[model samples]
Target chain A: MATGLKIKTAAELRTNYLRREMFPTIFCDGCGLGNVLNYTLWAIDEVGLDLDRTVFVSGIGCSSRLPGYINADGLHATHGRALAFASGIRAANPDLTVIVFTGDGDGAGIGGNHLLHTIRRNMDVTVILVNNFTYGMTGGQSAPTTPDGGFSSTTPYGNIEHPLDICELAKALGAPYVARWPVVSPAQPVKSIAEGIRKRGFALIEMLTPCPTAYGRRNGLKEIEQIWRWYREHTVLLDEWEWVEQFGSPEEREALRGKLKIGVFQDTERETFEDRWAALVAREKL
Target chain B: MHTIQIDEGWCKGCALCVIYCPTRALQVAARFSPRGVHPPELVRPERCNGCRLCELLCPDFAITVTEEGRVHA
Candidate 1:
């Protein structure tokens, strides 16, 4: 337990929440996704979310495989289209809550358009984009999110291109809620995911997880502990970065290295796409 | 009316089950079972809430609740 947890009985996370499997999960030892999923489910239960009315859309990749592991009503879509699938789900049933799960590459790369438009449209969707910095599912190819100078199959010479700050990108595109978290910090992640699950508008919870099999081995931090250490040291909570908010600009975003800032970049009471569409339909009498 | 069992072999005695039990019916006793697992004992049956908190918090998968003429917690 951290020094001051303010240990409350309820956990702000309902532990009884059930999903795809029983309590015992079969994820690999030290797998961060399981912790993230546990937090996600706890959030769902805390918010009293209707599982029947909630739909999860997953794209092709290790992170995308998460939806299938959950019992929630969800669909495993093709590569980089989880957002599109989630969009369709939200479009068809405005009342339902749609959540999209995508890996870093699938989301920030090919699914980039889907993500941009989803936020622009302010669709009622919660996107939990897991950024492990490498393509763990397919033999460790470099990802759009891999830190610059990080080694990957495609980046043996070190990645020349910069990694995208997803929360900033989402905020720029009009997402009502945007935040990032490290998977190891279980409690806050759970609270953050719950916040996303309860929000009525577009929300992004970017979890910076580690791919020990890919990222760790290539970086010479082969052990899971080293990766965990990296996650802890490199990623600073958004609140801590607020004082340094003056360091804002595309140039700074691209040049700044070493410290990976995490937190909710933006949250507003903007009207969601569902509201606008419903109003439009009401007016058009369609 | 109820049936519950904990796989003693897997219990790590995390005490999460004892902490999460809404009714506080389950408590870790000083005596360990034959398998050396500190099993949960129901000290008070009347206050059982049947919320399954014990089941949720058992990190070691070591507790199950079953009751007769009432729902298990």
Candidate 2:
């Protein structure tokens, strides 16, 4: 709310939203962390959230390093404990806008238990999980989100285990808002994230980002552009898939064997944990 | 008329903006930046239609498309 007819430039927006001192990010040349951060900032701007009131939190991982680059108050917590730390911050100050950044390995592997309970509680917070398939920061280690038969440092023989579908799990756990989008497309993610930020209860946005140096180099995607193109080619909209399932021929349905589903898995209104806690506090009159 | 601004220090020269530009106005410069990567340059400023696609798709937040009419304090 500064002045008349001021259309903020991207550079201006970056200066206002990000820590300029932290420029020249440590992320590899083709890494998608920059895209994720860029989209998140765009969402924040679209929603007109007060930067001073917002709090960013993250645990250990390549994605976790994002909050430190943001301009707002941030907490760089222990490995796989970002959700726990974010919950504490929200509970202590319910008025603040709390957002947590986490990676696939940090959120779905060691932090899996916390993720379940947090969604079940329906805490008022926004969680952005950047799923790069492998633990990119740790040199291409296989993660819980790594696709079946995907190669990683630990999975040189090909990952035999099935990947964890965090979006489906969050939907079953009753998270108020949940969605997944690959970093190749920014417009959908920006809109979805803006909606998630405006929603009251637990909001989770899982982004499939490229880790060219680590994941892509090992996998078939040798270049960064190949990763984006792969996402574009592999992803199928949920509605389209449903139509294909109900009406399309067996051959047509069989054609979608390895395609990834992308869209808002769940979005429902619910009483948040903070509201319930406030009610109890009032009833007890302590 | 719109002018394209590129933050030389911040750009990693991913060419995402270059590839996504609708007007084909952006191209990676032959000269390297301080970061040793070739930064994208606005080769044909007149061809830019203010689509802001490059602005939105820039991974590093290095590019900004602004018009001549807008005033900033």
Candidate 3:
């Protein structure tokens, strides 16, 4: 909450969020996912939140590797069970701010149930999902989020099915907050995710990242810069609704095939299930 | 009066100069650059030994080391 914003040296950014020593994360150059993670960590420190009170959970996928790269308390779990693990952490330590980072396949496909029930319960935890248009870890197989026309190992004939919009699903599931951002839109995404972290109840932020190594090969995008250009043209900001209000739906999402839209789509305050359950089961009340 | 010139357009935004700089005269710019990456700038000319690690390590061949005592095209 300190006043006006200003650009900082990457060195300065590393001091708090990176802790000056814990890890030197291994991520390739020009990878937007790492940049987004760095920005997210910086935003966390910007809010002056107690880092020790934070916990991170992730599932199997290339993006799942993120939780391990971060300085937070990370639990690398099985495919699609990140939400379940995070929920357990939250249920055990209600004071901690739980964050879950997973890939499109892990969160939306295998873990979709955990995602839904986690939101249905509405216990406070922030969800950060990356839709890189395909599964990156297991040799670039087709993911539930892969675009209809995009290429994947299993979709060599060109994916005929449309991609799933995780943000839309979260909103439909009655999540208190839902946002969608691209990896390149660091500033706005960082700010919106900050809001999501401060929010109570369920919050989900979907980021469209570039899998420069795997999906990039299938899509014929050799340079990370090329994929980044895709994000720059297609994505729009929340304040710039004019850029996206006209573009809606999964088919409309294709209009963003070469682009992205970043914003906080939903935000509402609600009673956390954990708090309510605790109060209800208190011995004093009985 | 001769000084090295860094071709910003060819610069790849790598840290070779920042890390290999013997005199600690260089630092990466903090602002968003035109190439959409952090560009290097000569922060302390006094510290430059003109050893040219920046010239050698430039991934894009963006930097050139020029001798102050020589005049050449």
Give candidate 2's fnat, 2 decimals: 0.57
lDDT of candidate 1 at residue A240, scale 0 to 100: 51
Which pairs clash inside model 1?
A20-A71, A238-A262
**Better by DockQ, candidate 3 or 2:** 2
Model 3: which residue pairs collide? Answer: A234-A259, A234-A260, A235-A260, A235-A261, A236-A261
Q: Higher DockQ: candidate 1 or 3? A: 1
lDDT score, candidate 2, position A21: 91
Please report how far candidate 2 places residue A188 from its true position, in Å. Answer: 1.1
lDDT: worst 10-residue window of model 3 chain A? A1-10
Clashes of each: 2, 0, 5
* lDDT (tens digit, per residue) of candidate 1 on A111-207: 8888898888888888999998888888899988888799999889998998888888888887888889887566677677777877788899999
> Tens digit of lDDT per residue, candidate 2, span A1-286?
1122224567767768888899878888777788889888878887899989999999998999999899899999988999999999988998899999999999889899889988888999999999989988888999998899999999999999988999999999999999999888777888788889999999999998888888988988978678778888888888998999999999979988877789999989999998898899899995
TM-score of each: 0.73, 0.94, 0.74
Top candidate (TM-score): 2
DockQ, all models: 0.06, 0.61, 0.05
Best by lDDT: 2
Q: After superposition, how far is residue A157 of candidate 2 from its true place, in Å?
A: 1.6
Ten residues in a row with the worst lDDT in model 1 chain A? A1-10
TM-score of 2: 0.94
